[model samples]
Target: MSIKRPRTGGAWSWHQDYGYWYQNGCLYPDMASAFIAIDPNTKANGCMQVLRGSHKMGRIEHGRFGDQTGADPERVEPAARVMDLVYVELEPGDTLFFHSNTLHCSDQNTSESPRWSLLCCYNTKHNNPYKESHHPFYEPLEKLPDSAIKEMGSKLFEAKTDFWDPANDETVGTGKDQ
Candidate 1:
């Protein structure tokens, strides 16, 4: 499941882990995505929250702006943490849609539940992994449709995609197709 912020805010924001694709004006993903919950999420437990329209910020220099909640003190604006953030709560099967740049975070698990959530992102074949390290995870791009691509500046990413198998206990990285 996804998270959402209160209704009072600007249009959008941006980040590294997540961000608004300026190539595409809309924040809602052009590609398809899914949220999976291993356990229920609640306000008492750690739940996902999002800042509406926070993606439009266009990649803020997190350290230049000044943010302290970062897990890495030295790496300012590390990944998605560089963008604005909002906390979201969720229940099993309660899915929410967010734009690419939407700033979001998972709250602490105040409840007994594990609050597990699987965030799967997809794009067109034309779209490639933002980071070189992510290359091995995706299939090759060949005549990928526009609907399948999420535009980020000159870069492109697969939009219409699905995980062959998530690396969970049963699907451990044995190097075989899940």
Candidate 2:
């Protein structure tokens, strides 16, 4: 659940989600995420960009880049020279399921329209963290019927949700072992 405001949203540096998550205590790279578009996502509006099959490259070196941690350009630039760069354009309601290790990023939004999206991340039960952190541990999720979405409607936004606060948290890092 993130919003990329038009003309204000900044670009995301190339990186793998697992490149950071592995440091969170997850022993395996068995995770996935579903990104659902809430608004039209276009290249002009900073739609996601992926390096096809880059997940097979495994995790690359990551370090602080501006306010975010990004993949080492020394490694990523060489790969990008030969990998296929895909701009993931999507319409409202479109969904993209991607591996956690996938190398992906986005450009700054230059369009007049916003690009909002909801990302539902899932970790395999076998890949549960060894220690509790910002990410949820292995807890069985209650299955919801498809119609449940329509039933919730606007009420979903009204419900109280616990969100991760990086300011008060130290869950994000390369870990003590790294």
Candidate 3:
């Protein structure tokens, strides 16, 4: 929900676009993707499947969008949906990292066992990425001590709207990969 920050549907998108793209258009350009399986992932249990480097496929026409592909009677890439996707079978502690543009989706839990996982996304920090009207955008984390806040590189954006009377803002981007 926080990935797109406050844009399109903005804070009003808790359950809507956050999970399914219920709205016609709201998804921001994807930056990174990660998923953690609470229960080990498997085809029998409906684990996630991804199309390797699909995100890098030169911006395939988004059928869901009002693009030319949107109204095509046949899918732009019907085979790509299943054939191009790679099934992910993971160990309990295993982690998979991939480019943000990777096309990925999961299967149904046909197995009797339950599955749990955390899908994390990383994005390029844009300067004032939020929609113009959605000012004071915030995605909060648990309270951090001042020392830790400095360590994390957050900076104070505003004292007027941020939750804490005194706020901490990290100037993100000093980390390793990014």
Candidate 4:
């Protein structure tokens, strides 16, 4: 999950999460992510922007942009010129399910209110990584009822969460060899 704080939030360059994931050893691009809005998401607050149906274009070349990996602008620029741009504005509690290869980006937040969101990523069992990487290998997920969330309450946040240390991460910078 990630949060985009208002006024100080930075922009995400146009890129697909799978563009980098493919280099992480995933053989196929069969993955998805759920973006759950924790706060109102609006263009003024840097709501996600997507090129409609760009996933059909498949993964484009990705290269470094500072500490971030972004899609090649040479290819993205042509697509942006012909594709319809969609501003994914959402109300709190609204959820957006997107394919991993979907080309998406966001502008810097210029609103007074924050744009907080949680992104739950999922990978298909058949698309398991050939080797371990920054993401997890395929494992059967336990089914939980909707009420489980409310029942857990504050206890959920108390659980020890394993966070990725970028300094130790081999997924970025090293390219496919990682």
Tens-digit per-residue lDDT, 58-107, candidate 2: 88878887666789899899889989999999999999999998999988
Off by over 4 Å in 4: 141-161, 170-178
lDDT of 2 at 28: 88
lDDT of 1 by residue, 1-178 (tens): 2332232112111233333232222233444445565556555555565545554553432221222211222333453455444555556666666555444555434354455567766665555445333123337647866765555346756877454433432212232211
Location of the lowest summed lDDT over 10 successive residues in candidate 1: 63-72
Which ranges of candidate 3 are over 4 A from the true structure? Answer: 1-30, 60-84, 127-178
lDDT of all predictions: 0.43, 0.83, 0.43, 0.84
Task: Give candidate 2 misplaced runs (Cα > 4 Å).
Answer: 141-161, 169-178
User: What overall lDDT, based on C-alpha atoms, would model 1 receive against the true structure?
Assistant: 0.43
For all predicted structures, in order, the TM-scores are 0.45, 0.82, 0.49, 0.82
Model with the higher lDDT, candidate 2 or 4: 4
Q: In terms of lDDT, which candidate is strongest?
A: 4
lDDT of 3: 0.43
